[model samples]
Target: MNNNNNSICNKSVHKKNVQHPLLINFGENQDGDGFDEFILDTFRFVGGRRYHNVSSSKYFLPNDLPEMDRLEKQHYLFLHIWRNNFSAPVREKIITKRKSSLHMAFEYPSAIFIGVDISPIFPSEQKKPDNATFLQNMLDGLPFEDDTFDFVYQRSLASAISEDQWKNDVIYELHRVTKPDGWIELMEPEFLFSKETDAPNCHKFSRALLGFLATLGINGFISSQLENILTSTKLFKNIHCEERSTPIGQWGGRLGEMMCNDYIESAEACKPALSQFIGISHEKFDSMLENIRMEINQNRLYYKTRRFYAQKA
Candidate 1:
């Protein structure tokens, strides 16, 4: 509350995240090009992380994702575990610090403001996600050297590939590229009834559909077994699994109803895939689905969704 305190900010929060408008907007000379790329190349790298060589060495902080995550975690780690953001000398000053978070507000405004960061941000006609370089290859052959990314995330490929492919190819590729002290996460669904209830049509239909998945060489039970599968590799440490009991009917409320509808829609796509395994006509399968829908509601079913995350040693 001092009279000498800053009043007019530069239409921004932190001085680090904000820049003169000329850098962030177009010059009006012609189509905006080269400026962004040129500015980005100036974000000098100290070791492997990013730093602003444009600034004097007084503010020595790397504005990389790990650093950003740490700053956010530092706030919570102090607040919840240690019980504050540690500006305890004057809590009012701490409040001021919070009110001035350029990154927490603007830095995360869109993943566009992010990079693998844009230096002083940028002026561009197109925004790229994480400045991500999109490349594609078979999961068996991820295009990277050993110990690459700081983190890896994979989801919902349970029905596309065989169990062997999952165990040998996909998981291995992820592990092989992740750095030590890094982390990887896997999310999948077991598609099992949470409890064995008297939903005959629901039970029958699930089995029939799983039989369909079998023909495609998918491990339909992948979600339930993900934790075990990850542990079997023994390549990671501090493995953790979180399970979600997603309700399957209106009785479970809004989220449950949506989950139920999603399952129905997913199942409906099975006819083309399922036709080879099950000899039922399209009309017959359609009728079966109607019964399954009614039975799930009557029986109060729940679906299993599981996520497993672990750190590398």
Candidate 2:
């Protein structure tokens, strides 16, 4: 996919991928947490359809499973298939933007694709195979030469690495692998659960779910702390931050509608597995999904996306 003559890959030969191994960590926790099911269902719902990249304001290839870990790879695979199955507009949106990205990068050409995650399934190797590598170690303790990579990217990592030590490990690893002028970008969303009486999208449920998730060692509240963490570590320079509150179930627009639908389907797909492994009663899980749907339909609860990128000095 890197065959563009853009700024992101100019000096480099026009290749579809680079050799510097995109180290992506997989989250294989199919336990009671229901995360695996959610991921799978997400792919099943919108695997191929083009979605917005809130960061670049552009669309890139959407895969059911990205060329990362097992879970992600599965999703990118779904994405590839979905794209082929989508209507003309969705397909056009994706193709046009990806081409634009290639063009834009030709001018900017600094190495841009790198990913790292703390895998839960086999810590030994990445779930799937790609040009990427899987680290069997903790994120806080990376074993790499100093300044090894151009950029460090992470998303939805909180559930695997709790909040307290999350930032410490993340900062440490990002700092360790990043080149002198590299960037570290992180993306995480909050998990909200409404009270039984209020339904979905109620601030109360959102707060309660957020609080519950926090206690479980997930940093569902990492949105506000990203900038502070970067600043405190002094590991990054020229930090830029952006936040977007996406309504659940695509309530805000086409994208939001997609998001909302994806969440519900993902929740349902994993419900059986979640109940089997996590012991969450089916009733409760269904209730939660229903609540989420209600909120989206009512234009009540939404999620905020916080993205920040900084250069290593």
Top-scoring candidate (lDDT): 1
lDDT of 1: 0.50
Give the poorly placed runs of model 1, Cα more than 4 Å off.
1-130, 137-140
Across residues 1-313, which tens digit of lDDT does each residue of candidate 2 receive?
Answer: 1111112222322111111112222232211122354454333233333222223111122322222233433333323323321111222212233222223223334322223222222222333223322332232244445665544555554444456554655566666656676555665555553232355334543454445555556566676787788888877778877655555444457655666665565445444434444456778777767766876667545556555667787
Clashing pairs in 1: 78-84
Off by over 4 Å in 2: 1-131, 134-140, 192-208, 250-253, 265-280
User: Each candidate's lDDT (Cα)?
Assistant: 0.50, 0.43
Which residue window of length 10 is worst by lDDT in model 1? 20-29
Q: Which candidate is the best by TM-score?
A: 1
Cα lDDT tens digits, model 1, 1-313, are 0011112122321112111111011111111234446546555665466555554222234444454444344333223322322221223321223321222223233211111121333223353323222221222254345665555555445765567766766676667656676666665677668654487777777787677667656678888777888899988888888766656788978655665665665566555445445787777887877887787777778777566778777
TM-score to native of every candidate shown: 0.59, 0.55
